[model samples]
Target: MKKNFTLIFTLLLCLFYIGGNAQTQFWSDTFEDAGAPSSGSRTASIDFSCGGPPFTSYFTRTLPTGIALQNGSYSLFQGSKIWAAEDIDKGPTCTNASISANQQVTWSGINIAGKTGLSFKGLLAASQLGGWQGLNFGAAEDFLIVEYRIDGGAWTKALAFYSNVPAASPASSNQLYLDTDGDLIGDGAGLTYAFTEYSANITGTGTTLDLRFNCFANASAAQELAVDNFRLFEAPPVVAPTVTTTAATGVGAVKATLGGNVTADGGASVTERGIVWATTANPTTANTKVTNGTGTGSFSAVISSLPAATLVHFRAYAINSSGTSYGSDLTFTTNAALSATTSQSNVFCNGGSNGTATVTASGGVTSYSYSWAPSGGTSATATGLTSGSYTVTITDSESTQITRNFTITQPTAISTATGSQTNVSCNGGTNGSASVSPSGGTPGYTYSWSPS
Candidate 1:
């Protein structure tokens, strides 16, 4: 009873496991709380725009001490808490919600004290939004930071810049750079600056993405940065896939054998690779049908029973973000069935004995038919065949045939003969002719007589 119960439990578990893996149809991303600032949690603190709310909250440190928010506006003064004495002029004014010459504000010391730099970053979940144009930071002079986070963890710096200078002047390029190779700040003089663009490849499960920015201040603090244009808009997604096949030996089956490899890349995998057959001599196509498994990188399937004259073909394909990629067709053929043969030793006879001939079939032949013709006569096994030339033809079940021919000669038997003289050849004079008779092998023959 216990054994039966255990078997039932195992079967149930297997069914449950298989049922849980529903095929994924459309891909999607889990929505994330994108409004948070570069630092603070409850209210996004990173000041996306140089002159906006939820702005300074995103900043860890700000320059020009006496910085304050009044009536939805910020005031910057040399003596203010967020300000420094080196600020060229005290409070710059934002009139009609527009930045004027004096309204320009820079956050210094952001990169100083070993604090993480500021950046502007963007995130797009595959499931959520589509048809995004591109991401834009403020003009070059704004000297903003752009950074991104994967699956919402720590903020990694993406790009950084210095003040493009002369606010309200023609725009210059943003400056962003790493410290040569290390993360630590290098010597203050001649430090490389640049505005960088970065891309992230997401794999597995998590979908939420995060971004932040740090605005650098002026030369006064040598520690500040600035921020501008903090917002999120969709950007085009990325696509690239790789396809490869496994190592294979030369096809050896009399009938074409099918085999293949696996595919990857472009966020896709192989569903099937098709194989087919053809019959034309040196045929590229024609009378073809899929012989192996379907779709994807690697798989194997027989083309069913094939004739010796068949030529087979193979092709592969994969589905990815960019649609399907097709592989070039390759072909191999079922080698023609061959017939092989071996010759039997020559037949030797002593007087009038009989002789026989024998031959063997090789290769793919299941059965063999043999016929022989001799210098003497034709026979199935060629028995009692007198000494003479002979030939044998063998046919295989496949109908392929081959022939061998040889010669046979018999040695003559020893001969014994006797001779007699007629009546009387008395006293040395030959009266009558002597006669001789021969028997065996040489038959009746000639003879000569001499008397002394």
Candidate 2:
């Protein structure tokens, strides 16, 4: 019978194990290439007769809520084709597509059926950088935005800046970002996004041109910021960017020291501000934080309490006024715990000297302590045992300790001797005698007598 029961239990366990291996299900969508659409593939036919550079109206959905700039033949605003120094630079005169307050302009249009969006491209001179400062974008309080017109209806704001950002540096080097890996917003400096296509949702378009670059405090004068290759097209399926953990060492714990760089192309960042740890990739936003956002750009945390054998994964992120920018993920592991804990099942029994038992510990214990109480225990080197309640405590080399508790019960006493018997002959003939006794209690006894 016992063998049959064991076999049945094992078969049930096997069935449960097999059930756990069920595969997860998922689905995906595909789209035609924007670069070269094949037969039956939808492509925006653009006419450069208005100016140079062909326009591709692939992304036609309304832009996300942010600022935008337009150039090339698709520019909705007049005079956008010409590049002039006095039109969009810092100094008194703004020039080029880098709109400045001095040359402020607002363009508006309708989407009017068909996926006809907008597009533009140009170059910005490295010198024209406002350094860490940028020209005002859209309204001061609101994000700079690109609005689209669908079916000739009212315009709506599209595309806005995201949160993550890289440290601000002088515009000394040129950089490029494409939508291939992710959204093509320039790493930290610029960004790009697409809208849904084919839907009658979009008709015409317009853009707010207020964001421009101004010189930093230390500047000789104004420089040129250029822009070009702008267009709207059918939105495409976004690819998830790959995230990897890279650290100074594989050590789980990171030390507080001079700062280092963590990089990722498609927006990346460490989730929190304090020192945090995890064995998984892409930890949620709650795991870590270094300095609690003092704006010092330093990442540090305290984690001496964690076990040495455990591993830690970390990532860094930068938050711009708009949204979050993420960096690559990093990972490390600790040595292991200096000590561990063990527990014994709670025990209940009748009060008796034979109830005593010793718990054996495998790990070498440096100090053996004990505790005893009705329902609780304390830490002490040795504990004298009693009846009603008891507990044990043990401390290890790591200064960590564990406690266990048990209880003892006493049986009720029974009464014999009937009603009091009257004294027969003389003083107290055959005086009634009564006695009381407790089991598994103190070994001593005392008594008192009274006359009736």
Candidate 3:
């Protein structure tokens, strides 16, 4: 289970933000109890207008119901209440409300002492209801000006807002914000008068942070503004990404397929991921590696041109801003594509079973094993073979094998084709004729023909 950090900001409403990673939330405010100054929350106001109304307060916290916007009245963006500069009751003689001149309202001293990567956001709603059709949006400072500062340092301007008005302004440009959806009723009612969210990233750290909204007006026209639901966030700490090395597949003498999985990114983007291999165990990126791609998820690559009949070690890896991380080492062994050579001796003489078939295995693991066919031989050499066909199956230690087929042959013995002898036609005669023809065996018949 994951730990949760959230605060309920309102009585009837619950407001909070969930971090993308395991990030921490420093501070947040929904202004749930915003009311008259008598409420005494962490808020202050200042009035700087000519007879700034007949009121002692510069701002009033109330339910957001913007009536001046041409589109329609405003509603609370969140919770039940908001801090606004608009006046609820305008006196008979007062030409402007409490937010006439350089009036300001501040929500101060929100703690963020040791926070880094500070991000903040809030909701704002307003309209240029009365005059000055300006779209410059606080460019020259007219309506609500949102500013923030750290540890009471120099205030940094963030965003400004305006309201509904005529399309053209007689003096400076106004009506920077209006109901642009065309559903509202006003001269320049195109932009929405609804409350919208605005966010900004803040750098530097301090014990406390302050948010201030300054409302500037000519003390002649009526304007409305409200602020609500401000939140701050901090990014999660970064570490090396988590990755797992998968087992090698399709392993061969010189090639293999291997890959890995990026289970977690450790709060940072995985910029690089790949595989590394070497003859030794625990290989690293400094060794032979194939970079697959960027980001998370499963990826694979082929490692080729490896030595034959060797044991290789490989690992999967991933890279992020934090650093590099590797998976467990995986091992695979390659056999040398078994092959063999053979020498055979035919039957020494006809009708003799002394033929020999011998095989020399190579291209495989050392101490090779051999099997001969015809149910008589199991070693490298097969002996006592007649004139017949035979086969030998040579296997390596790694279960790789090769079969060699050979024939045990025999030679014909000497024989006579045709022969005749002149029978002693003239026995013991001085002119006795003898003739004979012989074939077979090795040519050149010898003259040891019996009765000499």
Candidate 4:
């Protein structure tokens, strides 16, 4: 005969951790205060264990020996009830009086496909078993087994709660989970146990997540075992998220739009995502960065104040638990400011309209369209002439434009003199006047009258 609670430090309390990452809780159950079974099933076995079998009934319609209960009452963790397997001598409910043995309850069809960092949590408690003393046939060997499996894979142990047999129990300590170094728990100090929270992690992948809870108790002692409040969670992976960089779009003088798409979260949520750029071959967040925002998805940001006609290398990035991850290196050149120059011929005569102007445009978007204010000409080359200041708006395919002004001049004609005279209105009044108007040469006029 062996003492119970061989897994006190492991299955009962816990030794492994699920890390500090936050988890996504998906399901939970607090074993309602539902009425007890009308009759207990799963007869106790001559042996004991999670896989114990070939059970042989020692009693029929068994009830707890101590703690009087007329109708029996099942404890509740959430509503007013809990899943409990009372001691053999007494039934927790008035309905079921038979002691439970080699029995288990299962929850099936839980979908967990593509999910990672899975963890299971629950509550449990147990009373003293008689087997520790080696006094009678009912050595305390009853326990609880909680386990799960993915996509119908082999059932993996998530958590387990065993009968508390103590560490220093008698010669029957063989069943005390003795294999693993330092696995034995308790100092045989207390005879009873209290409720404690337990947790376990489920690593790997599967289509459906399934769970099972097993309880095995006998009628030999006044002890009992109970369970409540079961919970499951999916935590973010500890690895970096997967992301891809998109080519720069809307490249223009002084600014450009950069973006990326996050393909996978790497089992974790993306805390940040964005684009980084620099004139160098490989740019990092340290250079110039545009924060699109948090989370995984397609995002874009516009980097401004960039020098024109310059080549820049950039990359997209995402942040998560495992740190930062970047997309492939990408490069682009910003458009230079649009510009133009005009070559012209002065009007042949001072007031001639035959003067011509031709434009040679460079930089900015390709396709060009020219609009001349005075001539109303649409082509890059304008004719028909005019002796005056004119402005041509040079526009590119993207609606970007530039203005240039130039003057046309003709050599001053060999003084073509023309004069107008008015006879004196009043004979000696000196009111008569002589004037000359000049065209095409420098624009202003000057005259000198000799002795009126």
Summarize candidate 4's per-residue lDDT along 31-54 as a digit string, tens digits: 442332211222222212111121
Which consecutive 10 residues in model 3 have the weakest lDDT in total? 1-10
Off by over 4 Å in 2: 1-272, 284-291, 303-310, 322-328, 332-383, 393-402, 407-452
Cα RMSDs of all predictions?
Answer: 18.5, 23.7, 10.2, 15.4
**Shift in Å, residue 322, candidate 4:** 5.9
lDDT of 2 by residue, 69-177 (tens): 2321112111123222211222222222222223311222312122222321122222212222222221211112233434334544343221122222324332222
- TM-score comparison, 3 vs 4, better candidate: 3
Show model 3 residue runs off by greater than 4 Å: 1-25, 34-42, 47-58, 65-72, 87-100, 107-118, 132-141, 150-153, 162-174, 178-193, 203-209, 218-221, 277-290, 304-314, 328-452
Best by TM-score: 3
Give the clash count for each candidate: 65, 91, 16, 21
Question: Across residues 153-271, which tens digit of lDDT does each residue of candidate 3 receive?
Answer: 99876655444443434343355453324322223322234556665577788887787777654433434556777666777678899999999987766677899999999878999
Tell me each candidate's TM-score. 0.32, 0.25, 0.55, 0.45
Rank all candidate structures by their TM-score, best first, as comma-separated numbers.
Answer: 3, 4, 1, 2
* Residue lDDT tens for model 1, 360-420: 5564334667777643233335566556667887665545567776655555653445767
Worst 10 residues of 4 by lDDT: 47-56
Each model's lDDT comes to 0.36, 0.31, 0.64, 0.60
